[model samples]
Target chain A: MSTITLIGAGQMASALTFPLYENGHEVRLVGSPLDDQVIDRLREDNYHVNLLRTLHDGIHYYKESEKEAAIQGADLIVCGVSSFGVDWFADKILPILDESVPVISVTKGMLDYEDGTMQTYPEYWMSKLPEGSKQEIYAIGGPCTARDLADHDPSFVGYCGPKMETLHWIRSLFATDYYVISLTLDVVGLECAVALKNGYALGTALAIGMAEKAGDDGINHNNSEAALFQESVKEMLDLLKIVGGGVDNIMYAAGDLNVTVAAGRSRTVGLLLGKGLSIDEVMEQLKGQTLEAVVIATRTARAVKALAKAGKVKESDFPLLMHVNALLNEGATLNIPWTDFQKEM
Target chain B: MSTITLIGAGQMASALTFPLYENGHEVRLVGSPLDDQVIDRLREDNYHVNLLRTLHDGIHYYKESEKEAAIQGADLIVCGVSSFGVDWFADKILPILDESVPVISVTKGMLDYEDGTMQTYPEYWMSKLPEGSKQEIYAIGGPCTARDLADHDPSFVGYCGPKMETLHWIRSLFATDYYVISLTLDVVGLECAVALKNGYALGTALAIGMAEKAGDDGINHNNSEAALFQESVKEMLDLLKIVGGGVDNIMYAAGDLNVTVAAGRSRTVGLLLGKGLSIDEVMEQLKGQTLEAVVIATRTARAVKALAKAGKVKESDFPLLMHVNALLNEGATLNIPWTDFQKEM
Candidate 1:
């Protein structure tokens, strides 16, 4: 059995242990400083309060202080920290670790540099690592929710990176009958697709919410939702192509976007916006919740807008993105410009 | 105002009048022989029983006997008949149609011939037209439900054909502030995509039904549904490429598929099946309702299987289509082989 060191004790980190344990891998789940209380609880009872499930006996829990021990002699390391924590882990943790160990990231997002360059989570993490560290980094993406993963419900995820061997090893280590993995070489495209999905889902959720608010409760707004999805994807493809990513990478990523729009937290936020809640009101209502779409909308819009100003990207190519950016940052109303939507790119 | 003649007094045909009337087009709505009773009701009162909407005063309703009068002096003709009726309309009605006049079809389906050739409705109609008839034919497709269209809920449709002038004319005649029309040169792809959506929706419905049956009540299977959608679109793109259609035609078509899979009757049928009902039981349960997916699944399976045998198409490339066919035709259980699913084309 391979020793898998998972850095993060959040829902995803906890849930991922199920598949590792099922595959007979020795799991060392190390919590971050924020997860100290949760780690104490897990150590006390082996039950994850957030996931509402008990970890398998083969999985071991580790506190923040046990970081070095958790990584010692580990065959593989997976970072399941939130996108915000990736930089910290790369800077503080990578310097102390052996450079030869492979790393897989479950964190999904894009980082906007002050210089207007956008880097995917894996890219940012790699750049932050010690020069010449050469750690093979793969990103796990798609609509695999923590709750569903914990339930062992059928899930599919894309394993994407430059190193095919590392991807294959990571796939073998985590894939279960219910947890299927597909590999892709388009890391930039896959990461961009997953990160942008949150913003798009928010847009679709707004449609559903608007329909409901319009008192068309019994009406199926699938057409409108589908139209928005189509537009979102079109914009995504254009943006991906401009960002030097493969358009075909969207085929793998489209399903995840659909899932998120249909029923993810991003859509939940959009639903509230559609129900006549302003962005500020919605944010107030969702107080203390980590709205990933909000962050993505703000950062991606800023990054893309900067790119557009540099003539590297065309802003008109992505109306939905601009609208979302405006809604989040400029206090723009949630009234989507349906007529302004292009039928084809 | 252009005089527009619509041959088919079904819900779609009736709903379409709202836009034409709103555009100030004179509408002559003629029912098929099967819809004689519906015509009688429509004549008795302006309210269309199926669409649950009152016909605009400008729309002139006609019986099957009045088809010639309906078409007389028409600027444009639209066939809104079911796929089965396309042949009959082409054989019986086209001979009477002015060869110079243009035609548009709102009907979405494919016809399977005994010789194993599958032709979309527009293709079948085009083939039936006289040699050198050169009557410009356009197809209207997307996630447009008759109910939503009648409600004027900001809808978009793909107007596709080889003739740009005819397509532009039709778009202008049908375009309203809330009713958007986009043009495409990909008649084959759009028709095939729209026709095949019912089958894909059924497949997705089965997933949703299976999830509901699995006792995960609050969880959204959007991921699984999205996965199925991705597979469906991949198969569609492969099939479209084989059938001389643009793969990018999928961008225009994906929304319709999403809408259909999200809320179409095909998905409704799949839901019943997912609830542990046999095909026969589900058929019995949905008696008096038109199951488009059921028909598409059987005929498409037959046609695709024949193509596979002739080395024109690969059957293994389309596992979901094959599984759906077996479940419907071979009395096979509704067990989806998720592991056998291809991640990408």
Candidate 2:
């Protein structure tokens, strides 16, 4: 029975709060400038964030203003807010928190609002904290989805921190038979991993939609659709390297787990777009787009740009990353031709 | 029941034969020299092709030498041989046959060994006949694999002919509950459709492998692997367009079906390679490797070059095709950076 404080009432915040509560942990949920309806809904639903029809329990909801007070005695502080809210929460909550409280990030990516890998979301947030603050931040990622988890779908999620103990603690905090969790101490590796996965997810959705429209009336392969999917995986894996992920990690992404993951928010969002729904109107249709992978890809693309500029990343990965970034932001309409990349490959 | 004669007894031949047999059609099987053992095994086992405990019945197996006599009265003569054997069989068999015979080509591509297409395959094969002789050739394709069909794994298979009656006849003859067969008279479109699917598949395997090998650390997403897969799909769609595949087809290739399909094959091959197996060893280990997309990518690269020289394919597609060709033959290495691309997005 650990007390967990989650800062944010956004889609991700609700997602984390409900699950932690259901797992028998006491959770304090906080959101920035949080609306009364969201708070009312959280309280009425018992911290339940319903998606595909499952309810999660045990959350004590609060506004962001109450975070410091609410988190005072908490064993763990998790930030499940969007990338923009990291600084606001860190500034207000860190000063009042106990020094030893382990913090876990249920969010999927680094903030993309700036330049340099040093400017990534968590790194930027941690930089403002006291010197030893880096050890407190950890990230949880992988194929798990908010909608699915909200629906109580049996799923796999991964958490990575600098220390094995921190990771283990997080695993224990989030673990359940229905929600299988794994731990790793590769903090630097994990942040980008989730981000890349998100980007790939969004990009894949676009690519698949495009291929379905194209069919098998091409000059080369009999079914260009099959060729497109096959090649899309390969392209995603390559971009993974440029962004600082390992090949083994991509094996999982390009593997069934990530591929099988339902992109609920992205799918709905894309479908709305396909059906001629404007983004703003579609944004009003339901909750915000919580596909962390897309957000992460955008952020990591910035980080990779910083890495490349600093001479940390190789020059060769430039064009590939450029193509991916374009797709992540504008959708997958601008992938480079492999034939254009023979020498590089 | 319609009498169907299947030519060639390799993996594809065996795969194509079972579905027809399972549909309760009486199939007369003919094999190349290399397929003697395959024929004997099917005969000894009472004509069964087993894939992971799913058994399919195989009926009437024979050697290529016996095809002439066996196929004499067959209503539909379907050939599933490698692109290499089209000429040999056409010359030997088409001559002795009646002009009214309808032939269905299960091969998605032309034999580079002899120039062929929906136009050329029939034109060349029928040209040798007496001046007044006439024969109809139909081409069929879809995403279905024989191995999957043998195991009764439900999937879509398609057939196309020059005439509606011919297509309807083929579809009716081949359709079954387990196999969903669609018929079309867009023979030219169908020929290229199946052929282009290979490019997307091969490009996917190559790109994902590279990304995974380069930097996607056991994390699946925004890292290098996702980027690469994303990029590869974009590139494939671009190339598909340049090479004559419709833009609409790109979505299907990028979709879940294509992603799942490629992920399975790429992971299998990649895992084998990662486990220190040679490419040939990996190829040998999987029976489905025969239809492996890379073979078609390479073949298309060859065809692109040929078409470029003859001014048949688009000029823009030529350069990209040339580049892919180089990559396939050279086995080049890629070390792309993510930083530059992030800025572009």
Candidate 3:
């Protein structure tokens, strides 16, 4: 068995350690600087507070202080950090000398510029390296939730790397019957497709909150959710087209959007918004919680604004995203512009 | 005000009377020959037992005996019959002297042949008419549910016909602030796209049933649902492509499938299956309840088998549909063939 170094102890990273461990791989789950408490819990009783489950017993936990020792790994490295920990990983982990190992990340966010351009995390990380550096980071995106993955519920994900071998190697390393991996070379498309799912998922969850606020009694407002979900996918396909992703990738985006809308931290945020809680109130309430939808919505709106200023894209192109951006940023009310979401389809 | 004749007095037909009354149209809700009891309730208490709501006072209710009067001076005719009543409609209602009236149908099903061919209900109806019959039946499909429509939830639907005038006329008669109508000219594509939703919707609801059987405690298994949703769409697109439907129509299919999965009669049946109830058990449980998903799943399997016999399409192209068919028709177990669903993305 090869050594697989997982560089974060967060929910997704921790959950993924199961499949890797199940495949008999030596998984070194190195906690980030912020994960000291989690690392202590793991080392103490193998319990993950956030996941609310005991992890595999064979997993070797490492504190952030053991970076150099963890960095001298042999076979593969998985960047398990959240989008927030990316910079820390870059500053501390990237400076190590083992440059020949293959790296794949579970992070699902993008980097945008004021000039209205977007890059996947891998692209952004690759740009940070020396011009001739051969280090390539693979991309992963799909509907696999951490709890369900740990539960061994059937999950499908996509992995895109520099080559087919990179993908197949990853499949061989971590693929299980339940954790299905689909490989493609269009990393940017997969990244863009999945990143867009978060904001739109928040958009779809608006209905559940609205229903709760109205005191639903054994009935639902799923027609509204279905329309919103459809709008979300249409807008997501728009971004996928813009980012050079294929139409085939919409399945992945659909899967991600479906799960995010169904349950998760993002669903909670979306439900609160729909329940008429103001952005400030939600922010105050969910302090320190990782609101990826909020981050993505605000950033995507910023990028769209810059692009619209340059006449590269129109503001009305993403009415749902624009409306969510308004809710989270401009202090707009919970009124959705349903009429604006139509264009003859 | 133009006269709008809605035949069959069913849930959808009854629901549409609200919009027509809102628009000040003279609505004639004619109960089909089978709807005598419903008409009796409507006349007695102004209540529809099925919709469980009192309809508007403005709608002129017509019994089956008044069929001749209802057809005399209608500006439009809406074929509100289910797929089962299509033949009765053709035999009894198509003979009326209403040659110039525009017709639209809220029915979302198709007619397939043993020769591996499929025709939409409208096309099948047209085939039986006189060779030079100029009457064109417009198509409607989207995520609309009867209760949601009665609640005036924001619903988006596509109206595709032989001409734009037919769609616009229907839109004029029905469009409201909450009921959004998207117009297109791809009638065949819209029909094929929508007809495929019921069966796939059943496929997506398997996870919900499976969860119920496992006695989930404050937990979800949406990852499975999301994967099934993705698979359902992929297979729906396959049917759309085969039936000359465009991929652009997938949002309608997605919207329809999403609603069916979340909450509905079909979702109930799927849940029973997932909860370890056999097909016979589900059949006995919901004695008179409408099982559209079951009907569609069985018919789709029949057509697929015929097609496969002629080498028109492979049965594996629709693993989910075929599996559901086996469960409902062949007494197969509830085990979903998840591994048979993989192909390169």
Candidate 4:
């Protein structure tokens, strides 16, 4: 069995850990060195998935200092840490990882640095890797949520990276009856897919809630949704392309994720909005929870706006994107009222 | 039991028949003199929805001549006929029915001859009535589809007219455990809601399908749907105001008819599209099925376009509305790839 060491025990890390364990890997999970509650849960669940499936006896958990020893002889080093924690891990963990060992990142979004040139976790990690070790860092992406898989309905999605072998290794490690079809290779494409998909899914959730409140018959009319879907996909694809990703990113982003309707975290926010719950109430609920699609969409809008202002992207894409951001963050009030708008519809 | 004569056995007629009969109304189902399976089924069932629910012994069926006689002393003349047939009925049936018989129409869209006026079936019927008989016609609208009611899940919508008594009668005859909440009055407002909601639903469906195809997650990005939903509702409401409809029409259209994300037929089409069914295939399956929202959206787009061309509406609203029509018809395929355009999603 391949020895697998994963950094971060947040949502994505939790989501990734189960698949790796299921595929018969000797897995080691490490969360924040700071949060006692997070580390405690990781320590408890490190041996198994609680309330869902059986746990692997070979699985282990570690503190940050113990992470180096955990990965000392590992075949794979997978990082599912947040964007904010990448620098900390890069400095602390990279030094201990073997020079030949490959690292795969499940994190999306840019580092909130002034330059914004550094877009993803893999990019940041690759930069820190010793000179010729550039090809060792890969980005893993697709439509995946830990809650959905834990519930056991079959869900299919795509995953890609620049290295075909690394992609295949990751795909082979996660492919199962519950989670199927992970494509190997195309890092930029898959990265764009996951990043943009998160935003779009949140948007759909927000709209569904608004449509419900406005009493819209939730049916497709005049191809209204089709246009929005297409235009939004295109805009995200174009923006990603301009930002150094490929057009294929659009395909993975649009098709692979089975989250056409919102569920879990996004749905919770949407339902709260439907009940007229304010953003403050939502924030309160979200405290200490891993950042969700709603949070991601807001971050994306800010990132895109910055990109547009830097003259790296088209100015026209901002308004719609901004409006979408407002819909998710500020709630339906930021959107046009149902009755006032339905007249035009 | 009060005698209720319904003229039409189309989708809407078939849908409404069950509830009226179940509520203990002596419903006389009437249709055009044609040899059709649905008509045959209605006759055999005695206009009963027994196959759908429990058999209703109170319901009856009749020919056109029998309908005229049935309506002579009927408590209500409820028409669920097609838009094209409304005039024919107005010419033939209205003359024979007693002037005191109040009518409620479920048909939407304007009469072909009265293209300039945004008149619905009730309005067309009123115009043909003798002096002071205008008050006899009313309408029930918003997104209560026949399929939903036939499935037995409760569907709530709105009923409106100029008279409070007429609105009350419409609500009393229609409302049931399976059907609830018919917000009272304002015929003009009801018509505006009906027309606009249908058009916008179609637009929303197409956009959802397009986004799925374009490889973008349809979740929360841009809440593009919020824009479509809000803008389309506004357009419909404003048009109603500009052309003269009750303020209540906007509320009903924008509030009561909103389809649940799971319940919307158009969303089903989009989901099928995501599952790799072509639009043509979808249309074929939907052949002979009544998709009122889709039909009305198309009709609404045509009406809006014509109004725009005639300089009766503002040019500013043309892009989104016109684009909605184009997407519904064949989608914006100009320079887009066939795979991108024709992707089952």
Candidate 5:
């Protein structure tokens, strides 16, 4: 059995070990320096507190200090760290990784380059690797939640990168009957779509919140949500196209984003905001919570606005994105100018 | 004030009178031949028993026998009849309708032409009207529920027709601050999108039903629903393109369809079918209730299958459509072949 090194002990990383372990792979789950306590818990109990279950016996735990030992002879390396940690992980692991070993990223976010161009997580990671490195890099995205993956509920995800030939082996390494993986070479589209979803989810959550506050008894806000969903998708597709990604990737992006919003967090934040709570009040309500939507919304909006200023993207092309960005970053109100929305994308 | 004649006494028609009456238009809500009892109720109580609320006092009710008088001097005529009644209404009213009076259809469905062509309701109505009649036909579509409209909840709908100039007056005539309207020239796409939504809603309903039966407690089936939704939109876009409509129209179609599925009827039928009730059992359970999704799913599937045979459309292009059709017409089990779904679409 091949040994797979997963460099992160977060929820996604923990959830991912199930599929690899179930596929008869030896899993080395190395926790970040910040995850020493989690590593201790895993070593003692073989359980992930976040997942609320004991991991399979096939898993081996490693602390951040054991990085080189964990990566030295692994068949494949996977990075499941949060987007913010990609650069740090790259700096730590790239020098030690074998040039022959391929890397697959489960991280979804955008990176702003020094040149002011926005790069996806996979792109950013690949750029940080040693020059002339033959190792292929791929990104995984779609509606597969960490909890659902852990539960062995049927999950579908997209594997995307420039190296199409490498995906079959990657697919075989992780895919179970319940964990289905579809392949695409549209890496830019897939990564951008995944990163931008959190921002869009915030917009939809606001609509949900407004519907709840409107107090139409027994009438669900599905209509408003659907409208917001369509608009969000349109804006996403437009932004993707502007950033040199395929519009076709919208299918996967829309599906994944919809699922994410429906399952809470982003929507929960939006619901509170939509109920007429100010940003400060909502943040107080969600005190001590790491709201990914807020983080991504602020960052992606900044990146897009920068792109717009450089004439690489048009501001008018993305009214919803601008409104959402303003709402999150500039303390703008939750009033979405639905009338100014373009009918065609 | 402009005199407007709405020639259907159904829920949508009844709901629509609120806007017209509120806008100070002289509204003549004429019942079809089948709506004798509804007309009697409206005349007696000025309330739609189905809506559980009284209509504004300004509306003028007309019996089925008063069709000629209702249409004689109307500034505009709107048909809110169900799909099944479109042909019957066209036969009755086409001869009496003035050539100068524009018609707006709130009916959403398709008609099978004798030559094996499928025409949207607006097209079917326009085709049946007197040649050289010069009457502009438009369609109103979106996530507008009759109950919501009657309750004066904020609603947004699209007005689509070839006559761009006519939309201004149409918008002004119907749009309240709460009842918003957008305009498009893609009448074919709008009508087809609205009609086909029922069929797609059935597919999504089945997904929801299956998710509910799978019993993954606390895990919202939003992922499954989202996947199904994306597939539905792809099939819709493909079909719309094949039928000489814009794929851009997918925005409105997706929004309307999502809203429709989430808020009952179609989903109810799907849920029951998903719960292992045979088609016959579900029908028996509903008794004499009119299930629009069931009617549309059977018809749309038949139409698509016929198109597939004629090389007009590819059967492989629409797996969800084919599967739903099989489930409804062939008594097939609720087996969704998710793996076989096209990744790009």
Candidate 6:
């Protein structure tokens, strides 16, 4: 059993310690500078602050200052930072890394350009690394929730990177029966699919909000919800194809979208909006929350709007994303465009 | 306003009368030979037994003996029968239809031959029509539930047929602010996509059962359910391709699959089976209930097995369907083959 070092003490990072610990690996979890409190809590009583679970005391915990020590002699490193921490990790941690030891990221994000081109996290980091560096970065996708993984629930995910051999080796080391893995070489597809799901998840969950706004509690409004879901997936498919992704990558988008719409923080954001709450009201209510879904929604809209202006794509192609952007940024009311959804062929 | 006659009084058939009446058409509801009780109840109290809601009184109700009187329509006809009533309608109702009027089916079904080739109901009905006589058969698809439609909830459906003008004409007469319609010429794609949802809905619902069986009440098991849903969609994509259907036709399958997994009777079957109940126990418990899911599951399984023998498709391509088939017919328990779902690419 080789050592595995995780560079962020976030929920996903801490939760992942279970499978690694179960696999007889010497796992080291090092917190970023902002995660000092969580690191302290974890060190004090084997309790994770965000995951809210009592983890095995055997895991080695380290603060930001101890990151170098934690990274020493690691066979595999996990880039477990959130999108907000990407630049932080790149500036502070990438300079100290061994280029030969491969890293797989749990972070799901993308850099969207106005030209209808998007870059996955792996691409972003690979560009930032020293030129001709041998480091490899992979991205994870599909409907994996931190709590579910910690609970040992069966979860499916796509492990995507450039090298098939590296992906197979990572799958061999990381995958449990519960943490089932599907490998793909199309890292951009998996990353974009997962990132797109966050915002569209918020959009799809508007059905609950729509129902609540109408004061109809008994009906699930599944007909409308399913319609929104299909439209979200259709937009995701279109966006993925535009970004040079694969068709089979739809599984990553559709599955995770369902999970997020069902129980993620994205659903709560959508529920509040569906109740006719404005952007200011929602921001005040959910203050101190990350609100990545909102961030991604507005970001994607900006990119799509730019793409539309450049004649790369049509604005009508993303009614759901545009609507969500309006809801989150422009204080627009929650009125779904039912007519825009019905396709003609 | 034109007079439109519907040839069955099932929940789906009866539920569709709301849109027809709201569109200012004179709608006539006719019972098949077996729907005498429903017809009598509708005639006596203006109530539908299955839809469980009061409908508009303007709709004319007719018994099986009064079919020809009801069919004295001017513009169009709705073959609003369930799959079970398809043969009955073809044998009894088709003989008297005026060749000039177009017939749209709310019934979702298909005939699967042992040769891995499937015939959609529209194709089935057209072939059975007398030689040299013309009857244009169309189909409706998507995530439309009877209760939601009868409640005048916002719904989106695809109106599919051979002719664009005819589909457009029917859309003008049927679509409302709430009852939205999408028009497509891929009758086979839409039909197969919808018919495939029933059995897969059963497979997707196994997550709820597995969670219940494990006594894990706190978790929604969205991961497993979403995985099952995706697997169901993937298998559907493979089968739809094999059957000469279109790729964009997945919206019909995925959306309806979500609806069925959410509230349809298929969920109950999956739940019972997931809780480790045998098919005999489930049958005894749900006796007298018309389980079209069971029928379709076994039917598709037989056809697929034959197709596999002929080297048309691999059984591994449909682990979800094959597992459901075994659970229903082969006395197998509810252990899902998680390994089988992982894709290597």
The sequence of per-residue lDDT tens digits that candidate 6 reaches over residues A54-161 is: 788799999999999999999999999988999988899888999999889999877777665677878989999988999988778888888888888888888998
**Over 4 Å off, model 4:** A34-54, A111-118, A211-234, A255-261, A270-278, A292-295, A310-314, A326-333, A336-345, B1-261, B264-345
DockQ, in order, for the candidates? 0.46, 0.04, 0.61, 0.03, 0.40, 0.67
- Candidate 2 regions exceeding 4 Å error are A17-19, A45-58, A111-120, A132-135, A211-246, A255-261, A267-321, A327-345, B1-63, B66-345
iRMS per model in Å:
2.4, 14.2, 1.6, 14.3, 2.9, 1.4
On residues A1-345, what C-alpha lDDT tens digit does candidate 2 reach at each position? 889887776665566665677778887877667445667666676544433232355567786666667787899888776665666767776667676887777665566444454233456667778876433777766655565455444445556666786666677777655555545665544455455555545443443444334455232222222332334444445555554554334323442223332344544443343344344555577565445544555565676677667777643444444554665455545433323221111
Model 1: docking quality category: acceptable
**Candidate 5 chain A weakest ten by summed lDDT:** A336-345
TM-score of each prediction: 0.94, 0.50, 0.95, 0.50, 0.92, 0.97
Cα RMSD for candidate 3? Answer: 2.0
Error of 5 at B290 (Å): 2.4
What is the clash count for each candidate, in the order shown?
A: 0, 93, 0, 68, 0, 0
lDDT of candidate 5 over A1-345, digit per residue (tens): 899999989888898999899888889999987788888999987888766767887689999999888997899989888766877778887767887888888887786653346688777777777778787788888876787678766666788877777887888899876677778898998888877888788887787888889885755556567667767766777777767887667766676776777775787887887787877898899997668788777777777778777777767767777887777668888886766563421
- In candidate 4, what are the lDDT values of residues A153-238, reduced to their tens digit? 33445555566666666667776655654455556556755666565555435544544554655332312222233334445655
Tell me how candidate 4 scores on lDDT.
Answer: 0.57
Provide the lDDT at A279 for model 5.
79
Give the i-RMS of model 5 in Å: 2.9
The global C-alpha lDDT for each of the candidates, from Candidate 1 onward, is 0.79, 0.54, 0.84, 0.57, 0.78, 0.85
The digit string of per-residue lDDT tens for model 3 on B1-57 reads 789899999998898888888999898999998899999889887799998778988
Whose lDDT is higher: candidate 4's or candidate 6's?
6
lDDT of 6 by residue, B1-345 (tens): 878888888888898888889889999998988899998899888888888888898899999899889988458889988788889878888888998899999988677776766788889889889999878988899888898888877787888998999999999888888888878998888888888888999998888788888884566577888888778877888777877888777777877887888888788899888888998999999998888788788778877888899987778878889999999999898889887888876
The candidate that wins on TM-score is: 6
- Which ten contiguous residues of candidate 4 chain A have the minimum total lDDT? A336-345
Residue B33, candidate 6: how far off, in angstroms?
1.4
Candidate 3 or 1, higher lDDT: 3
- The TM-score, computed over Cα atoms with residue i paired to residue i, of candidate 6 is 0.97
- Over 4 Å off in model 5, which ranges? A112-117, A215-219, A303-317, A342-345, B112-117, B214-219, B310-314, B342-345
Best by lDDT: 6
CA displacement after TM-score superposition, residue A307 of candidate 6 (Å) = 1.9
